[model samples]
Target chain A: MTSPPPPSGHIARNARLGIVLFVVYVIIYAGFVALAAFAPSVMAREIAGVNVAIVYGLALIVLALVLAIVYMLLCRDDADRAEDVAR
Target chain B: MTYHASSIAVAVFVFFVGIVLGISFYLGSRARSAKGYFAAHGQIGWFVNGVAFAGDYLSAASFLGICGMIAFYGYDGFLYSIGYLAGWIVALFVIAEPIKRLGKYTFADALNAKFNSRGIQVAAAISTLVVSVFYLIPQMVGAGALCTPLLGLPHWAGVVIVGVVVLMIVVTAGMVSTTWVQFIKGSLLVIFCAILTVAILARGFRVTADRASIKPVAATQPSDIPFGGQVVSIGNGDNAVGASTGPLGPVQFLQKINDVRVVQWTAKADAAHPGTTLYTPVEKQAREYMLPGGSSTFKGVRSPKLTDKLDFISLMIALFAGTASLPHILIRYYTVKDAVSARKSTVVGIASIGFFYILTLFLGLGAMTSGRLDPTPAGSNMAAPLLAKTFGELPFALISAIAFTTVLGTVSGLIMAASGAVAHDLMENVFKHHPNENAKVGAAKWTALCVGIVAMALGTLFKDFNVTFLVGWAFNVAASANLPALVMLLFWKRTTKSGITAAIWVGMLSSLAWLLLSGPAYVNIYKLDATRAIAPFSQPGLVTIPLGFIVLVIVSLMTREHAKPH
Candidate 1:
């Protein structure tokens, strides 16, 4: 923060990207939790072989990893692009 | 279930303890300065530190308590793992880079860096110590849990062993040793947990073919030794017997387990004895056993009662908020060299942690149907280890010992954070007694010793409850007390020193007060009636976390003009 801020568009892009991913994750996770809370029997329903809760739970965990990977790569690209613009 | 310590198991446990101590001593000579002692000279590799993140973050409660809960109750225990792992999102996105950039040594450093307020320093340091101590309780309780079956020693001995070993690790090499211990142990925890899960998949489910009556074991105390129930019948009918499944895949493991019936031990009020409990074996469908509302703790998830639903929601909030705010996890940011490395490590941590949590589903379900676990309500914490007992003694010993080191790693991180609070933050900063690096490290050693002793005493004092349940209290306090101040300071520009100070006190005290008066604590620790508890539920995060944010906002607005530029 002591340093000068990056170009406004660069910062905005990164912030918007980060916020979007975070919200996506929250909704994905919270949707599962909501299902568990309100309509647990729905969670108890079987898909293929696994229960809906198990399937949803596993998906959330896997989704978190994918999103983390996505964020890391995107942030690194943003940082590199900002550095290039400044140079 | 009572266990006799096999010579092989004891030998394995001893081997682990010695190896850990040896690593500590080897690292001791390297950490000479406060930077070396507290932050490992900021020379650690990003990947190793990332793995160390897994080690530091995944306490025994995750391994022992979650597995036990899943083993006993079903899918609800996995709920804790989900919340805990999801919290890393807050840490990775919001805290990791800024924390690395801001702090030189401690969490307090980053917090007070903006204004250099003695008030923020003192308050932040106190907050760190409180959170660390509260977190230490479950780790110590987990140490005892590992000791009982692995060594055949009493629970207190297990608590004392981790206390001493972790103290030596902290006093000797500080963060350098703690980080590596976490790194190695974290790696081992995941690897071995994978091995255990594979073993579970291979073994599948075995039905208890015979109906055996479990006799009264006299009046039960709350912390009574684990009780294993016999297989009364395999399926729904009394005639459904000899139902066995073999080498099932992950999905088949669950579906196949649905029809298997098992006897579970439950504690009931003794008709003859007023103040004592009677142990009774009850037969249950395995399908219901793996459902969300299986345990008394989570029965409210589907309960018609509003209080139960609120309790569930409150717990979820605490778990979500706790990770970003934890002093132990926050301090790990300093171990890496740069902000990028910090983020890298968090990603690695999330992946590693996420993988282990997935494995816990199989492990818990495995333990649930392992036919070895004591199906008593209280024995859920021992699920993973006892499940390991199904295969052989060697795996059980290794799992128990590794789980014990899980405690050791987390507790050492905690003690390091707490010692830094006293030695670096309180003494060097708040009091203006700027000791040289050597003196600071020496003071830290003494402080670590003191904190370790306190943790041992508290761990022994609190028993009879699952380690995960105790961890919920710690998470609530940390999220409520620490997260608001840190978040507002970083984002909300109006945050003033006075506001930070007031929020910390208000948040910390209110959560602690609510905890003491909550039903669980009143019934367990206070030896009083839980019904008399004034609070609506046990968890305080729902009310207190929001309160912290609101208080900081109001106070900061009032003091906005007084805020000086850095």
Candidate 2:
């Protein structure tokens, strides 16, 4: 019962953009998870006395940051409007 | 028993807490209004709020637990960082704007905006308290851990000190003080960790293996019948030490520190027998850490069983989903001016948090090969701090202080959150009692004190558990109880007040149920001589997260006709 008012086409459009971004996130993350499973040998490497998981783990952090930035872009308008109302 | 560096660290930490509490006392004067106490009069800037998000989010778990995990467990520990960062996606996409638009103060405000139903209030309030307590446990535990090296106190004293300090922080100014504390700590944490990382890279890895001789234990008992045979008394003195007397007798344990070799050890079973020792070379330290392209590697790329896959998958799900659900983190959005700033701040947070996580991978890997690891499970948490100490005692002292501040900032934020729930959601909203913001602020202050005390008690109670492992349980509960209701409320049209309330109850109960019934909690908490557990696995995210969504959907469907558009 407490859902916010529906967005104009703009909000829907933004949500759609979000869906696209989520799909991209899924693909990238899935690929990594799969690699961690099926071809660990090919993926594994030693750098600075640390193992492959550490390297890939670093990449995941970068991925999350980039995705977060992407998310901000996708939802900027709806978020702006919501902020205006909140103020 | 004492050193100047450790003393200085404790003094600095105490000084920092004093400054924060002073600000809270000052803010307490102005927080007479509900808006002033709960939302900072809705006046905080996006940047401050964003930094506060970091301050609130990077609790003891993120700083101490993750770092310690990496320090001891190698790459397996860093997987947590990946999971935590992934959760921001849910915050950005699903929860951010809706939460800002719908309600005024607590999460209950958002959930009950549509129906004005008391049920929603009670359920959401209870969930908030439960999740807050769970989250509180790790922070208190972390506080205790920090105190040992910093103040030369037992773990329980640290918990008590933090609880008292946090109570003061919450009682004095509510969100105003909490926000600034988080902002300062967040900036300090990021900058210091960056500096530490740079130091690690510049110094690089080195071999520092040390060996000690073990006292051989006599296999036979001493008796008059034995001639020219050895009688094994407790062997006591080592170098300049005193004699030891114990049930196991005087058995000397030897620890070899081989800094050059990053030996990842696993206990393997003998094919023909039940118990044995099998040592294999996981990888060389130099080759593992310093790949030609600059990356580290782990052996178990593809875990064989469904349980392995689920463990990995469930951890990821919790980390990604848990961020948006955390009570303290969500409150930061309220402190900001508008949704645009919230988005922008989140972007900044992502950048800072992301960068630090990358550094943790290096930090963890560095500790793994430093030969400073505490081989005993009980001592694993010391790996990171000890690694810093290995570089220099001052750095260790500094990092330990920062880590303690990390706990302080987060615990204060959480107390602020819980106090808001009691003062704003239940007292103000449910009871229909109007307290001027000042009166409400007073209520919030008292609530913070009570909650802080409870948290201290729980922290002392659960002191033996690993701080990192305890945090995972907190995440699991938050993700289950909070995330499903939040996402469905924002996106699904058919979601009714009844549906939201049901989701909160079911999601919370089921996850807590699964966790309590699972092997880890049973063995760890219950102290029962039980058999292997009923569930396929212990962690509940794989089961309970989906269950939350399912309950929300089904309840929404059942109550669709009753649902009204807000």
Candidate 3:
């Protein structure tokens, strides 16, 4: 259990955002790996020209890049707003 | 199959090496102070630092090992890229900003910042050194592996060349030159791989006329040969079609691999004749190779055995956890300015790294059908460069040279992290030696020198090994040793100095011990019976990582109030 995540400030908000985004990554990555392990037939099935395994793997990679960008945009904007308020 | 030396490869390799050395010596002048030397005075822009992150993180293993594995094993090799790139998610969301805010020079600095504990300093320092050295072996070995293919030199010569060049780079200009080198190297490596991937898509699958009639092994030898695999007729069939897909889209390119027949080799040396290399040529179904678990190493994904599944899961966990915890990667955050910049840079790294890893799949598959594999099974590390040679000698030289720079970028970061541990963590924090900035900088350079020498020496010692798994072991050690402590320190308030210290040492030693005593080490390194191994499984992360957390939580609970020195 996490220790009552810092009294709801910007840091806390960013941390919460990060944690949620991290979960998104976990879901995508874990789902892909689990599918690979438990469902080879599904993985081997061709979607378009690529196998489900390849599509999912490449998707997970793209999803990570997207997540990183999303996190950066969210936090960077928040950081700027917080700075403006401080000023 | 022995690799022949190419003059073109040698010339191009030398040119790249010269440019890197020139850059290092030139940048050496700027990094006089401790901050400049260790962290580039925190002046590097986020974008460059991020590319350097790609440069630093994408070690020889990623470029050579992953590509080689994919070339040999198919979908299983791409799994490493997935696992490796996945680790960056942890780095980006969790560690990047916090590490930038926490530490100054090294991972130990941030770790000890909260408690100012010598125990934390010593533990973190030792962990950095151990993890760095463990990581260096494969990189150096990759250096050697490339040499045999590019220059026809013995393995040790490549090892020495890389070691000496990297030492010069680190000692001359610690992080400044390293970052720029990595940025340029990282950028070029990505672009080149992208080019190669595009080339692969263009020059797509060419099915052999008699694609179905290849045997996995020509003959089964007595189970005594240690390191030889010779496939009789991988594909003697005439070209049914030329190796060109005529501008197929990426998806179409991957999909087409399932319809082509490829020859993949498996090398196994038996106990009776370890020197006798027995090679089996296996005709792989496109569907099989294009799908996951193409190699025996990743068999756990589909295996019925409980231990096998656990092993795969454990390896994935380690890869997921290891990236944020790696000392060199952690230290890189300190080279950037602020948390936002660090986050942005991490995004850039993720993008670059993700794109490259994606390319590795096509490059590997392209190599699978290239029919240019070194007849010797042991030379898988040269798969990508040799694949490049399929197009032309110039691209081969370029890929090989860039691969060397890949080693340099990574090795320099590792050495920088290692030397920082010695000077910043051990000498300054643990010993409480408040030396002036210049003296500390000087000590760090000397430490870099020593660490470089040590790395170079270690590079020579661990030659001719499958670096992919060795890198996995390094990741396990990093994840077990550093990830738990770092993550807990960030998230948990109850984490005491004692708890952190105990967790690190226990995690480090226990995991290391477990790895050394594991089944693979017994069979592979020691050349002994696998049953003689003490550890039940090869990977120690599933056990040691939790043990680290458990020990931390318990110790933290016990000494919640007793915040004493001892």
Candidate 4:
């Protein structure tokens, strides 16, 4: 017999979460790019012993990992619940 | 300025290649079936697959190009690091699970899963080959770049060496061996770069004496300098001072850099000589050196011209959208068991890749002040290796070997993707062949051999061309061609097979057309006046990516009534 397809409820829920997180990130990243392109002088200003350009660049890298982990955890819980309901 | 062949470097490089070949042979028996050859039988653990993502994604450009750019131009190179890492956010959050659930072997498998359209099979398979070949050229060029400095070999020998080694790896066990090779290289690259970063932090910066004496030389080429060619100089005249800042923390290093005066070089057409260029030194605050606009690549950001600003934005958008659409990266999702494994592995990839990008800032700045830069145009690609040489011969040897593996891992991945496109998508699906699993495997091996040879030839032919623009073209085309079709197919129920096919062809061709007729291509590739170019700017993503989405939407609406219900 053919195996059953994955529950659409779980898939839909995960896509929803993924889109929300992705939208959130795009806004933040757009801000970084805009500042560097249009208002570079502002990015050159020093803050906390480092320039804002360096600060914002490093923060974007860290924030990607942070959001990725959050999505993985949230999706894991949803997958587990869907599995239990299927059984 | 000169490279000598060292016995230690050769020994280390040989040992690395030997181990890679050994693993490929060891795994050769496990991949006899078609599934095993393409997707490792979906048996690889999430962790191995995750690091393999890092290995596959961080090509020679990420390691050597970014470091060299930063060594010469300061903070401008870090912009690439930021853009490259941010693309992973799109990959993990949006593309991972759907791709894993849909695809069995290749990216076309996922795009064709719903309709089983012959048109899609042809379009996507062709797109995969085009993107893969474009991406492969730079890695081959990188191999030549490394070989000249580390192994003292000619450019053609480097390309051939990498081509043959990757062929053996892919032809032996396909994805099974390719994944493991990527894993080992990824792990070693990260660990050693972390070690190098620590050394940079410990050494800190020192204000050295000015070395501004001009040596007169015969100037025949446009890039040849008439005078004043030092990479960096500190202070001027009697005010020059020599001091050391000892060991400083990462933040402290930036702050110290702002407090010094650094001399940077600018090239201009010589008034005295018609065809030759003159290099002149300009003194500026170290703070300006630590900011953007220090290099020509990023000078657009500070330019008042509207096209210049649009070009920068266009490139950033392409980079952000490209990573998720790459065929090699997409095919990697099938190596794991399920969608959950894909998600987890992507998280691991983002973590490893993100951390390495953060370290690039330190690596680049460290090379900037390392006082060992090669000032020639070719020397920019050698920044990281030359920096390692300053530490000692062993670090240099180890770093060079890791860099070589970097080329091997990326090239093998590209060949695997290309082979899958030919054997599985084109031969079986599009051409209506009824081959058994073993025959399919054999066909894929032959295809890999052919693709590897083609990559070597292109690498040797394009030896003198700037590889940076070739990589940018790959990203722009991949984003435009694949991203619109894949994203729309997954989300919009009205997306017709005709729409997907139309979008792929439009996106791919438009981006390619725009790149070839653009200003940069006019100057660099055609040897013509850039002002007369047809395209408004160099980068095409700002126009073409949106055009892909619009074409898909319009075509789907037009073909909606006749589409079969899923």
Candidate 5:
């Protein structure tokens, strides 16, 4: 049979962290969608030789990766601390 | 514009399929147990599972559909790339660890973990099947698209070949073989596309005199410029062709294209010839070509209509919310040992997928400026393969073979999810059957075969729709049906069994109903006037997704007494 889930405290901590990060991402993503829908001219303006649409799109992809790394690192620390407490 | 089956392409395709089959057969003996068949015994390494995630997630829609869209429509396709990758953020952050902890075989297992209610089991399993079938259409459509250029076969033949081959792969070994297949193809796809991107950068934009060779036709008169013909004119004059900007930087490539005018085609009813349509080239400024709304699919972004704008937002929202809720992707977390492995693998998936999406921009734009685009509506799916052909026949063969594998990897994952829903969730859990291990495996294999046949039929039926657009509808259904229950179950303390059950049904049915009555479905599926569509917008997420959440909360409150204390 499969083992039980991790301690509720640990799971709860991770859930809190995850939800916070998810909200941040949702806001950023919403901003992109809003601009594309409402302000086409803003997205049309060129930045660094490419338009803002391309730049912002690339940024969203990059930011997701960066945040993923951050979440992973922070979770690892939490796991390590939990281990210490258990010991 | 015409594609002939090359000896080299056929050989490479055969070699790729042979190797993939060989792996499945070798793994078949090891997957005799139900656990082995369904979840690879939960022993997959985090890294392999991670890349397998990339392999499974980057469907034919990502490789062929988006590239084709960008080739024809510019930045709008990349918008799909961005939305698709961002959905993984939801996957990585909210769903990964919890799903890994709860589920054993299928997504249904996770949803039914706390309650063990037959209602949840049935609802979630049906959702999995519905979502899987919807998702399979795009992969099957993609398979048909690839077969034409790769084997010089008709679209139906391609769909059939993929159906038969994917069935063999799934029925033989299940998740063991599927994971490895995804890993292999995922790595190869990324590596090859990176190579293709570098080649694109090196070649840059060349001012060709092909347009000058063609005699200009009046707007009222029929033109001889066939579909897929290059009509780009550089410099000041209408027919003027300037010097090549050799070996440009990525940024410089976009800047250079800003000075060039691209000819986009629009099809209208023929005035002179009855029962035939005429495709006329309309030259567009660089800004119009490079910006968002260049294609008909995303033209709503630049439109004044509120419903049009809402359609665009709904599509993006569905894509963002959908990734976390996909049955196939959720099941991948079960392939790994524990929640930590699930987390680690999701990070790897995000990194690989994000990087590949970034490459899609370069690859799509490369096809756009390659002077080799097939401008016909049907030709958009062939953009990437044709772009590779411009490089040489060998690159074309390799990319086509890899594109075929992209279809196989995703289709196998979807079928696995479906079969698990049938055998593990529906028959065993919901129906309360205590089947032996061998019997369960047998049931799953049978389910795989049946699903494969259904996918093949649908693939051929929906051959004309863009694979990416079809995938968007699948996303809309998946997100609306699956996301609300999943999120509430994980986060809310008062989520009851009835809430989960009611949410899945409400979400799944509402989204499906909305889609069948939407504008796109009216024109494409029903063959009726688009103006007669009942749904206000083409995409259903904005209405249906929230409806899912609200229904769940109200139902949970009403059924509060049914909740068992933890």
Candidate 6:
């Protein structure tokens, strides 16, 4: 039987990266939720006649775009570093 | 319940189902190899896969559940849209590329990629199957609901029809047919809903107080009609009553809401005639309510108090997180070619899904004031279609047919995902029972068959419950069980096989336990007094999601010294 292998150093480093990103995500989401549940007036001024709930609803639209850019940068850097280590 | 099966509606629905089947057959014949059967040989076009993502992701809850919620509950229902879309951020940023790179067929494959442990396989596959089936029930029920009106058939027929059609879709092309079907359904669902939304906005709110002008049949009496239910008396009086022509015919309504307050039918019994009930539309005089001012609009807009506010917020969190973490949606990453395509397709999916959700806001509110809300909670499902009926039978037929197809698209995607887990993940990898390409395809066929039966049984058992309500429980389960493990596995290198396995097990069991013992489940499903519910909070994401993370951290710490050296 093949012996079990340990996670590579790259994998370990990537894991750390993932933790930081996740914490960031939780903070952003919590902030958005607080604004939506509590700050309808700010939302109303931003979008006329729109409920805070609805504007907060649009937060996902903004979040998706931001997350896409972040993923590309972080994952590409990690992949490049892994290649360098291999060489 | 009335048999107004226009030949045009029947013809349109059958034609749609037929085209989907034809595509399935073509794809099935091509899916002879295991690679083809499991992942479409990773050859699916990015555009097609992207739309298929919408198809697979949308499901019955997105279509029927959200619409029903909006129609009945006002702005609260749209909160689901927010939650579901928000979850995708987690998917796109965190899981997509890594999932594409690591796994070949199922989510289990990716989890066990580094560990190569059989326990991980079993744990992950069990979660996949559990979540997939939980998701499938609502799709089947939605099919049954749509079929009753669209095809003028019974509930079970709709369930069977969807099951057989979906099974065929899976057995024929595997992912190929499933993907294309989803693409077509997804595109059409969004476009048509957009049209409906426009129609809704174009025709804004109208208030009327004509209490007796509108006439709705309350009950149908046995006249000379051959059907299950029919109208014997057509009385214009407010308390006129009727019975069904047969045992199961549509019971006509005398008093029904037609864009105003509740209408109550009062019947006075005559010595010879007994008493009869008639329809009377009630008028609601505007009463001043307090509006609390704040964020988007009303600085102090008068809305209901603390309980309503909490319920609304809870629902939004569930939708936002739920979308990113669904088992069915996560599994779609494997079918695409590479990471870039995965990200691109996700963007397309977000656009399509986001657009459709916005449309639901209109469709739902349209139904609310459509003045056609059925009094029973069960009838709430018909809000959108009934609203369409107010416009004309043609619009009603179109919406009903689209609703049926919505169920079909969602159910087909779910069955395909569940079958992949059985064929590719559990059977080949964990059990060490490798089948050839042909045999693997055979296994998938059988898996789809078994899963179809389970879905049907669930649909029938949940026949009385609202499909949307059941879906929220599914979202909670999905977010809790799968999200913790997936997130930890991708991000934490200290995540040992034991840690990952424990996270999944803890997440799955705790959420399931919370759901079973929660107040809502107790009152709605168990038929027991809600006060007996064991868990204080119903939504498990707040608790089980954190518990999963903690368990992983603790288990990893304990096993660190014994960890294998790199």
Predicted structure 1, TM vs. truth: 0.93
Interface RMSD of 1: 3.3
Q: Model 4 misses residue B256 by how many Å?
A: 1.8
Query: Which CAPRI category fits model 2?
Result: acceptable
Per-model DockQ against the true two-chain complex: 0.40, 0.42, 0.46, 0.50, 0.49, 0.19
Residue B525 in candidate 6 has what lDDT?
A: 81
Q: Is the docking of candidate 6 incorrect, acceptable, medium or high quality?
A: incorrect
Q: Candidate 4: list runs displaced more than 4 Å.
A: A1-7, A77-87, B211-242, B263-284
- Model 2 lDDT, residue B421, Cα: 85
> In every candidate, how many clashes are there?
3, 33, 19, 0, 1, 55
Of the candidates numbered 5 and 6, which has the greater lDDT value?
5
Candidate 6 residue-wise lDDT, A1-87, digit = tens? 122243355544544565576567667767665564565445444233343455555555556556555654555445634543353
**Top-scoring candidate (lDDT):** 5
Q: C-alpha displacement of B238 in model 6, angstroms?
A: 25
Tell me the spans in candidate 3 whose CA falls farther than 4 Å from its real position: A1-8, A76-87, B208-245, B266-278, B564-566
Indicate which candidate wins on DockQ. 4
- Output the better candidate (1/5) by DockQ: 5
- lDDT at B242, model 6: 23
Collision pairs in model 1: B1-B226, B68-B380, B234-B261
In angstroms, how far off is B114's CA in candidate 1?
1.3
Q: lDDT tens string, model 5, A7-53?
A: 46666777788888999999999999999999989998988777888
**Candidate No. with top TM-score:** 5
- Candidate 5 lDDT, tens digit per residue, B66-175? 99998888888999999999999899889988787777898888888888889999999999999999999989999999898899899999999999999999999999
- Per-residue CA lDDT of model 6 for B1-566, tens digit only, reads 24455666677788888888898898776677777777778887777887888888877777777776665554556666666776776676677767776788888888887778887888888888888898888788788777776777888998998888888888788877877888988987888777776665555443322434445534333221111111112122322332111111111110111112323222223344443323333322111000122111121122445433454455445555566667678767878877667767887787787777767766765575555555344555666777777677777777777777777777877887788878877898888998778888899889999999999988877776667767877877777777777777766667787787888889889988987887777876889987798876566666777788899889977876665733
Candidate 3: tens digits of C-alpha lDDT, residues B60-167: 999888878887778888888999999999998888766776678888878777788889999999999999999999998899888877888888888888888888
TM-score of each: 0.93, 0.84, 0.92, 0.93, 0.95, 0.81
Candidate 6, B340: how far from true, in Å?
Answer: 0.9
Candidate 1 vs candidate 5: the TM-score winner is 5
Q: Each model's fnat? A: 0.35, 0.54, 0.61, 0.69, 0.69, 0.20
Standalone chain B TM-score for every prediction = 0.95, 0.84, 0.93, 0.93, 0.96, 0.84
Categorize the docking of model 1. Answer: acceptable
